[model samples]
Target: MDYIAENTNFKLKNSAVTLGKFDGLHLGHQLLLEQVISLKKQGYTAVMFSFSYHPGNLFSKKEFELIYTEEEKLAKLRNTKMDVLVSYPFTKETSNMEPEDFIKDVLIGKLDAKIIVVGQDFRFGHKRRGDVKLLQSLAETYGYRVIACEKRKYKDSIISSSEIRKELKEGNMETVNEMLGQPYSILGEVRHGRKLGRTLGLPTTNIIPVSGKLLPPCGVYASKTIVDGISYPGVTNIGFKPTVGAEKVKGVETYIFDFNQDLYGKFIEVELYTYERPELKFNSIEELKQKMQEDIAFTRNYFLKLNEGNNSSYSN
Candidate 1:
């Protein structure tokens, strides 16, 4: 993927582009991306216009949990096979530009967009004055095609980045995974922990995810961990160990069953598949160990049954 940083010596001539924040690259964003990809095949170079920061983050005091980091977003866009990725810095000066100026100066003048694709609810420019209709009018004047992608709905709900974040925050992994086209994953490096699990005969690999990430609710989850391109089924916990009288800060720790490998200081991706149960305090260390054993057993059975069901459906 070609990365074009803001204010850099980079320019594209006559490109087909999609404009959006594209936080999670959820189904709705994917629809617009698909349109852009289709345009690329028709002899148009595809470009994506996105801001470095979410617009709301600039004005609002409350921090929003992002589904992916900037690197992750670029990776996702690369999968769409876009020819160029244009990242516009979100500054007060850029934000103050009028909607018309943004289209004429940035989109048309800088990128030279021959075709533009966006979602139905897409908006841009100062105070978000540019709507789909405004974009269409501008495209007509500039001799470019304007495509508005319809909203995507799944399970009677709009598949939006905000909705996906809400689902993840609520521990609704199943729905979030469906909307994301894969399991929601956290990419991080394995870090050293207190090794309490090791004392219990269940050594774990602890991970400290990047800041501002949307973590799943504190609990045990059936997950798949990938390290150096190899995947392993595992049980992960995202919480403070209340039973062992640990601190209140959040953490993600995973125990991969039937696998032993030294992974300290290595980057890995942990994909949450399903929510098992919430974190709880146990009366005794023996009780906690016993419950962990049960959790592992349940996870194994659950995956086996799930695979069997998939095989049966395929046979049918």
Candidate 2:
């Protein structure tokens, strides 16, 4: 997808667009994006209009966890086959625009949106005065169509970014994976640490994640780490190393099985598949080693069961 960072630099032809924060790119966001893709098949160009920051962040002092980086968001947009991605900078000034001005000046005049797909509860402009009903009225006056995507329900509850955030905050890996259609991931560069795991016979790669990214609750998890575009089954610990007396400082440590290479300064992506166990404070080095062994065994058995299920499905 073509990413246009500045609205002033965005010069695209008329297109059908979906507008949202798209924080988690959850199922509800996916539904809206699919509509934009479908519009593209009908000869309208598919575009996505998104804000660099959360809409609420402009109004509140409270900080929020982001589900994806700007790069990750663009990648997800590309996967939806969006022709253009218009990333508008969210600011106090931009937040103060009137609803009609946003539609006429920004949406119609700048983006040249032939149609807009938004959620039912979608609102914009000063004090969020713009709603679906207002958008429908604006569409009639501006000579464009409006598509309001309904809420996506999973197990009698609406799938939302907030719900996904809650699941992540609570360390509900299974629910998070189910709602996201994939494992929750964290991307960072490998950094040299004290090599405590190595001294304990389980060498690990340490990473410091970018700030503001949501992480799973502190625990050991079954994960897959990607290095140089290749994935390896691994076990990860997200905690302060309570066993090693480093419990006060948070850290992310991963030990990729059957793989050994210098990874310091290399960027890696770790995807958490399942939570194996919580961080524990062992009484001694031997106790910690035994627990580590158990953790690895559990991870191995989990992958074995996963592979078996996959093979069975294919063979049947």
Candidate 3:
């Protein structure tokens, strides 16, 4: 996919665009993406348009963390059939743009959108004055069609990014993964740690998350680590290693079962499956090691049952 971020000088032709924050790219967001991608057969460029900053950041004083960072969002979209991704700069001026002006300048003028896809409740431009009705009203004048998709539902509630963030913060991995349409994964390069795990004979691969990346509560999780495109089940600890140095920076550290290979500086994706236990501060290194062993056993069994039909193994 072509990523256009902060740079929008060029225009795309015959595009089918979907606009949204796409923060988590949850199942709800996927519905919009699928709509745009479906237009590829009609000779339209599939484009996903979002702002460089979260739209809510303009009105709130608190820092906004994303379930998927900008890089992570692009990474996820690359796997799809979509052709283009736009992270348009969001400034005070753009936020105040009139609804019709956004459509004229962005949708038709810049993107040359032949088809516009959005959720039923989609709104835009100047105190959120824009709505599906407005977009539809101008469709004839703008020479583009509008596709308003219904919101995806999970049981009684709507599948949304806010709800997924809530479930993630509460350490409900199962529910979060279900709504996400895939496992909640942390993607980063394996960085060097203090080698404490190695000394304890439970060596791990560590990844320092990027700034503004939202994470679940610090805990041990039954996870699957993807190394070189192959997934291996493991136990991951997402915390600040309070038992050892009590590092100030939180990190994702995973011990791939039956795997022994150098991974420093290599990129890996750790997918959380189940929240196992809370992070604990042990008095001794032996105590921490013992607890880790128990976590590993539990995680192994969890994956075993999860993949019983496929005859999964713990080995890499």
Candidate maximizing lDDT:
3
For model 3, residues 1-316, the per-residue Cα lDDT tens digits are 8999997687999999999999889989999998889889989999999999897787798879899999889888989999999999998889999999999999988999999999999989998999999999999998999999999998889998999999999999888988888888999999999999999898899999998899999999999999888898899999999988788999999999999999999999899989989999999988898899999999989877777755322223
What are the RMSDs of all candidates, in order? Answer: 2.7, 2.8, 2.4
Candidate 1: tens digits of C-alpha lDDT, residues 219-274: 99988888776778889999998988775578888999888899999888888888
**Backbone clashes in model 1, listed as residue pairs:** none
Model 2 worst lDDT run, 10 consecutive residues = 307-316
User: lDDT tens digits, residues 80-172, model 2?
Assistant: 677888889888788899999999888888888889999999988898899999989767789889989889887888888889889998888
Better of 2 and 3 by lDDT: 3
Query: Who is ahead in lDDT, 1 or 3?
Result: 3
Q: What's the best-to-worst order under TM-score?
A: 3, 1, 2
Clashes of 1: 0
> Model 1: how far is 172 from its true place, Å?
1.2
**Candidate 3 residue-pair clash tally:** 0
TM-score of each: 0.91, 0.90, 0.96
What's the lDDT for all of these models?
A: 0.83, 0.82, 0.91
